[model samples]
Target: MELLIKGGTVVTASGSFEADVAVDGGKIAAIGKNLPVTANQVVDASGRLVLPGALDAHTHMAMPFGGTVSADSYLSGTRAAVCGGVTTIFDYPVQHKGETILGLVNSKKEILERDACCDYAFHCCITDLNGGEILDEMAQAVEEGITSFKCFLVYKKEGMMVDDGTLTRLLLRARELGALINVHAENPDLIDLRTEMYLKEGKTSAWYHYMSRPEFVEAEADKRVVHWASHLETPVYLVHMADKEGLEACIRAKEEGHTVYVETCPQYLEFTCDVYKRPDGRNFVCSPPMKGKESQDALWTALKSGFIDTVATDHCPFQSYEKDWGKDDFTKIPNGCAGVENLYPYMLDAANSGKISFERVVEVCATNVAKIFGCDNKGAIAVGKDADIVIYDKDKDFTISVKNMHSDYDHTIWEGKKLHGYPVQTYLRGKLVYDNGNFVGKPGMGQYVKRSHK
Candidate 1:
């Protein structure tokens, strides 16, 4: 089938231009003006902005955390992702203690096979670092298309958290195997100590949650990780930077010639500790919790200055009732908030408000994510690239409501916020999945994309 998206401003990394994009057999066949071609389907994108579909490289679906699973399953999460104009998501696969990386990959594949509704890829979480077998398995997992591994520095007792020695070894192994190492850089001991002190003082409010995990903890750990990666000559992607200090560390590392990448989520950009003190504080609980307004301003500046490379949702949804599992104790609350369905809209609103350029929005939300995750054929509206496109209506304005959401979760962190821009249509692999607020494609149409060895 051939589809032509006619008369739209096609946004790309290089520039934006009014062009007609022709799609055939799941790839962009041509992009030009007045193309001499016929198509089975023609999408009149007049007056709208046609850009590459957003790629959310960090997401957790049906993930087990805090003794409860995330509310959004693969089907629900991907459905919401497509509805929000995200074409591809690189989800994390948690490797259990004592399990091989290959085994974890296979298990995640089995889980994804049952429910995913959009294109997907995997990033292996290195939980067990002491086992030498994981080193070889990391190489093989890379060969199997899992090109990135995530290791946490805060969950130290759990297999996912690694000490400095373990982190160094993992970085060396990943560098030698041609893979990227993603770090969840937070000082666990500091956080734990603060938590204990807060509990002893009988102060268990949501605000103290942020108070317990201060910026200096993250900044210290981030600075240390950047130095270690530099020493090992490994590329490090700093995940979910919460504030200015962490962003500065990333900038310093980049200035020092280290291949450091920084990713910030919408929560960091839009919300702050203010949300934690709201009557609905539970909805705002996440690791490296939202910071002060000053931090938010610094993050915005970082985004504009190119110090931040990408804006991922870090979409992890939990039911409101489940938040009580923490039971007035902030430590027990599951760490994550829901936003897979709002990433593009929030960023688009920012663009419309003159906070950033539309080209920069595409770069951070689509191009850079795909490049870092090794999805070479994605993240661009050009000839020979995958036909993953989104037509956004800048004239549209809508307030976010739970009633309009496609995710299984009943609430949104951005509820009631008015958004200026929205996706009018979302196409994946040359097929219309979401059109004008309705899902037009069926399940199983989305392929599991194997990333390139970039």
Candidate 2:
């Protein structure tokens, strides 16, 4: 054995038990009670929980939007991910006009290859069909192991919105190619209309940001996506879902046996539209902005009931000054918030507080993401899986502050939030990458993972 972790309660998506794990050649060699293996190194995890490191399936590192780029570069973002017990990240690479799907995806891979601190993959986001040339490249992208794509239903002015005709073509082709389509569901026409009305009425506060994108704006698109995928008989993924009606739409689709997977972010689970009333509410301006308490509670219920498939952080952060761009007008604010480094901690805290089971935590944060997104070797503590793991002390006390964070951003929506449990050590392919508030990993040590169709 190359390394051994002993005496911890190993939790998987299905169950938990006391066991010892042995790693060799960057993979799990064995798992059992008292393995009795000889190794180059050993870790005693007597009172901690040994679990698979999380895979953040949705993130926007170093992305450009609203005239400013996101705060975290690949180096800083992946570093923060590992510190938060996330060993893998799937970032979205946006396509520009005249760019092929593979071209934009490869460009993103080049950057991650040069600067990322942990393993990474990409979800190609096609903003322009390029006269359907990009559509022709979808199969090639999937053949190259990039099996997932994202399209927005809104953002028409940004040239990112895809019409139903394009979406239908993508969905049908995705079905044929065994690829999955991820939708950012929001009704573009309604959003534009509401925004114009709000601005004209002099309601330019952050609260108006939420008001313009109220539950219906998201629900209408959510139900439309469900209807489209169901009618077409293809599997579809809804990203950053945050509304009660949307949840109900998904549930109905599931009951009807349509393949619909939903992913919600930590922001929706932790905050509400009420945050917009605060002085710094502009910092909370994200698409499908956090809804009322009922929606938040409904999301928690859905998570507990196994209705939701994955929990990912739409980890796009802007600096305070950039966020202040929309202090007087919400539309100019960059629509995102930071959560990659806080995703696991918040869920683990909820589990420790008895809100959810530990196994459920692993299911949503690690196992489900791997299964849904085709990360074959990365999601469990079982033998033959990658030795990407976290040793968590459920009783360890920590407060989330930007002062101790590893990302390039200067502020966090999670600041001052305290947690009772946290990942104290994180390993990537059997190597100690993060330990006790410090990153021991080097930039560009990460590899670009080739993912298969789910």
Candidate 3:
């Protein structure tokens, strides 16, 4: 079926312009003042904005963490994603200890095949670097459409973390293979030593969790990794960066002509360490914990100046009872929070308040993410692209509540926050999957996207 979105401003990386977009056969057929094409359905977008649907590049569904799995499965997670105007998500395929990358990818593929309400992709996590199996499987995984890989520097004791030497090798190999290397940058040694001291002092509170893993630890690790990536001439992406020093390192690397990119989450932008000091701080606990107000301000500055490339949720969720597990020991709690349904509204609020331009919001939320993940035809409101689009009512105002959320989880960190913008309709491949607070599309309507390495 053909669909026409009339009288809306189309925002993209190039600029925003008032135009009409026509979709036929699941791709954008035309865009201009008068498309001169008939359609089976017409949407009156006169007072709204039309932009590329958000592409969330970081999320976890039914992920195993801290001896328990996340509460939301793929079906629930992607449902929530679509409700927030996101048409696609890129989740991680975590490699278990001693497991081959191929095995991990296949397992995740099976999980997604049964679930997932929206389009999705995967990033292979490198857990064991000692074996040459990773180097061997890299090309096969990339050929099968997984072009990026992630490695951690903080889970050293569990074998999930890779040391500087292993990271250097992986980055060099990825560069040679024409792929991107993503790093979870935080110095485990520094955090462990500080955590031990706090536990000895009987001060194992959530606030201390943030204090122990301070910005310096993240900044130092980021500087080291960016330097290594520069040396190897590899494209590097820093995930969940929380401080100004880390942003400064990325900016410096970029100034030196390296292909370095950084991403920050809403938790860092919306919450502060004070949330940890609350009696119920476990709700806000996450690795690279939320920073002080100063760091938050610096992150906003980085966003405005274009130092930050994207805003991802890192949407890892746990129930409140699970949060209770950390009441006695902070380390026992899962290190994540839920926000797949809040990404668009929060950023829209920021834009409405004059903190960011509408075009910049579209770039960070959609276009840039697609470019980084190698989704060539999925990011813009242009002719010959996939018709994954969003129609947002910019003047709508409402309070965020778990009552209105679509995820299986029971709580929201942003619950009760008021926002001025919301997605009224979302289309993936020119099919109306979500419209006005209801999901009208069927499962399996979304197809897996094979990213190009070009």
Candidate 4:
């Protein structure tokens, strides 16, 4: 054995146990109560909780939008991820006009391979069907193990949104190729009309951003996506779900046995539309902006009932100055916030505070993500799996602040939040990358992971 972790409570999506884990050659070699094997390194886990490292399936690093790039590069973003016990991140690489799916995916993979501090993968975004020429490339993308594709139902002005015809084509193609289609569901027409109305009335503060994207705007699109998917008999995933009506649509689809998966972010669970009324409200601006308290409550209930499939951060951050562009007009603000680093910790805190079970946290943050995305070797602590793990101290109290975070952003949406538990160390493929608030991983230490259709 090259390394051994002893005396930790091993927590998984299903259950927890006290066990000793053995690792060799970057893979888990054995797991038992008293291993006879000896290792060069033996760490005492003691009272900590050992878990499979979380997988963040939604993130945007070094991504350009709204005329400026996101604050974090692959290196900085993965550093924050490792600190938060996330071992792998799947970033969406958008296909620009005249760009091939392979071109966008390969380019993004090249950057991540060179600069990422932890493992990474891609969900190729298709924005330019280009007379259906791009549809032919979906098979090649799946062959290369990029089995999921993202499409937008909003952002029509940014040239990223696709019409119902485009979405239907992608859904049908994904079903044939054994891939999954992910969507950002929102009524673009309603949003645009409302924004124009708000601006005409001189009600352009950040609060108006939420008002423009009323629950129905998102719910209507959710219904549309679910309807198309059900009629076509294909699986569709709704990302960053934030409204009660939208979730209800998903629930109805699910109860009727339609394959509609829903993902909600921690922001939607913890904060509501009221955040838009703060002095720094512009910082809270994001597309399909946070909804009412009723929506927040619905999210928590869905998470507990297992109606929600996964919880991933749509982590895209811009500098404070960039956010200031929308101080007077919310339409100009960047459409994302930083949450990749805070994702696992916040979920763990919820479990520690008795809001949810630890097993549920593991399921949403790791197991379900891995299973849904076909990460066969991840999301569990078992023999023959990669030694990607996190040692969490459930009794350790911590406070979140931008100064303590490792992301490149100047602010965090989770800033100054308090938590009762946190990850103390993180291992990536048997190597200790983050330990006690320090980053020991090097650039290019991470590798590109080719994901498959589950």
Candidate 5:
């Protein structure tokens, strides 16, 4: 059915303006002050904001990790995503040892086909760069519609961290293949040393998770990766960066014209290491653990100043039982938090409270993500683009709680936080998928998007 979303400020990365948008055949058919078009549905966006649905460039759904799978399956995760105003999500499906890129990609495709509820794509995670055959795999991965490879500078103990030599080779290969690489940067050696020292002192609480991985650990590793990217002249995206010095390095590179994209999560921006001190502090455990108040302040500043390009959730939630595994040892804790359901309203809350401009919200959470990840038909309310849109009610306020969220997970990190503005209605491909607090998305309704080469 055609949809006419009228009388709202259409927000884009560039700015916002009052306009009427018409949708037909799942694409934005027209946009004007008064779109002289008839439609099966007319959405009264009066007194509201019309936004391009958020395109979360980072997500992990039903991903296997730390002896357990993430709590949300593809269906549940994407349902939460659309309800939160995310119409497109690019998930990370790591290629395990002895697994071919095609094998892993196709396996993930089967699951997404059966369960994903929003438009989806993937970043081919490389855990084994075996015998240089992995270099050729990078090119094949791009042809397979996977244009980005996820690499880790940490996780050495998990046998996931690609050595610097392997990372360099991967960078060189990705550059040649016109693909991009995203790295989880944290110096394992330094982190390991610190963790050992803290343990020796009998510091076993969740707080030690933060102490063991100092800010310098991330900054030094970031610098190393940035240097490698510069040498290879390949673009690299640093995921979930949380340190002031790390932000400085990324900013300096951008000022120098390096193609370094930085991403930070809502958890790091809002919470500090102090959360780890709570009785249930272990629940907040994640890799590149949250830092102090100073680092949180710096991360927020970096985002506002444009050094950080995206605010993704890294939504790899684990239940309380899983968190308990790490209670005896911080390293055993599953490294993730439930966030796909909160990305939209949380950012809206940030904008409403003057932490960021409304335009900045569309930029960081939607537009830039599409551009960076090559989501061609997403990120803006414009002609010929996918009609993935959200009608946000600025006058509404809702308290977030696990009871109302759609994720299959049993807990929430933003529980009880009230969002001043919320998405009253959401549409994916010009179809009503969510309204008020109810979800209407269907399993297998989401299509895998083929991204263009960088």
Candidate 6:
């Protein structure tokens, strides 16, 4: 496999430069200006940006949720991901009751080995965490390359919530093992109390979903989780931070000398609580629900200023039909939105329009995530790195809709939004996988990437 990407501006986390990149044997062979070498294939990236492929660190493909399975299976989800210029994805696989993290890892890896279209990994979600047996399994999971663990503070009814004491122990264990921890920070008890109060008073609409999990609900949990991690001196990554108050929780943690990484999604940056008033607002229902417009502006500002560490799609795709389950009651709706297919195009579109710099786009979507999650060989465009590349036509425009996207989900909250950039071609490990709206990669074409702790 020999390929050359020529006449493009190579965007990296720190900067951009005009260069020609060479690939051989699924790794970057050389990168230089006017490389005087030949290859079996040449991508004329003239007037386009050849970017390091985006790494979506949050996705839940084929996972069961809310009494039903998420719509997109591994094949469809990963195809959508690569079509959107993402060359890698790290999804969380939940540990069932009585299941060890290593057991869950093996099960998920088997499925991914047969369906994933891009290189993949898992963050062991410790849902049934228990005694020394579980801790021992966690160490084995780390050695097997599942280095990050996630625990939710919400979803108590689903048995997914981790108690404060257990979470503290997990944080300390992670710190001792040289692994990172991710948390879904939301106060479930307050959510339950709020939802019951509102529904009893006839507040059955989608708006109550926002009312139930108010920004302060997440903000308080975010602050408390930081305290837990700080007390244990463990590095923590807060997933799907949606509000200004939550951002401050992270900022305060950093100020007080704790290692904390923050991620906010496009849904939070692009939409707000107003969507709940729309007829189809239930489609936007997710935990840590989108906040008011003020918070939206703050997230964008934080992303640009580097205060926010990364952007991810929490890509737990549920169909429109499945989403309607919560129409009569907000609590019944499946929580999540589909945006893995939107990450690169949206971020690139924003970069083209000056909402963010190209470097920042690379930082949030690719490089920073790799650094945070220990994916050393996966992020940047350089020698010996995996040849995961995206040829983006920065000037080409497209409006987002499910008709053109590859995710199996039926609705996109970002529908009808115009974007002036899209991926024309994508290469995973020197192989032409997606080309101009077609998925050329086969199921199981993707390889499992073991994330080593650095």
- Which residues of candidate 3, in runs, are more than 4 Å off? none
Against the true structure, candidate 1 has what lDDT? Answer: 0.87
lDDT of 5 by residue, 360-392 (tens): 989999989888888888889989999999999
lDDT of each: 0.87, 0.93, 0.87, 0.92, 0.88, 0.89
Which regions of candidate 1 are displaced past 4 Å?
Answer: 157-159
Write down the RMSD of candidate 6 (Cα, Å).
Answer: 1.0
Model 6 scores worst on lDDT over the 10 consecutive residues at: 127-136
Per-residue CA lDDT of model 1 for 365-446, tens digit only, reads 9999988889988999988999999999999998899888889997888889999888999999899999888877666666
Error of 5 at 73 (Å): 0.8
What's the TM-score of each model vs. the native?
Answer: 0.98, 0.99, 0.98, 0.99, 0.98, 0.98
**Candidates 1 and 4: which is better by TM-score?**
4
1-454 per-residue lDDT for model 6 (tens digits): 3999999999999889999999999999999999999999988898999999999999999989988999889999999999999999988988867888776778888988899899998897887766567777778888888899999998998899999988888888888889988999999999999999999998888999999998899989999988878877889999999989889878878888889999989889888999999899899998889999888988988888888999999999798888899898998899989999899898888899998899999999999988888888888998999999999998788998889898888888878999988899999999988998888988898988888885
lDDT, residue 33, model 4: 92
Among all windows of 10 consecutive residues in model 1, the one with the lowest summed lDDT is 154-163
Local accuracy of candidate 2 as per-residue lDDT tens digits, 205-294: 999999998999999999999999999999999999999999999999999999999999889999999999999999999988999999
Name the TM-score of candidate 2.
0.99
After superposition, candidate 6 runs with Cα above 4 Å error: none
Query: Clashes per prediction?
Result: 1, 0, 0, 0, 0, 0
TM-score for candidate 5, please give it: 0.98
Summing lDDT over every window of 10 consecutive residues in candidate 4, give the lowest-scoring window. Answer: 445-454
Indicate the residue-level lDDT of 55 in model 3.
Answer: 87
Candidates arranged by lDDT, highest first = 2, 4, 6, 5, 3, 1
User: How far off is model 4, as Cα RMSD?
Assistant: 0.8
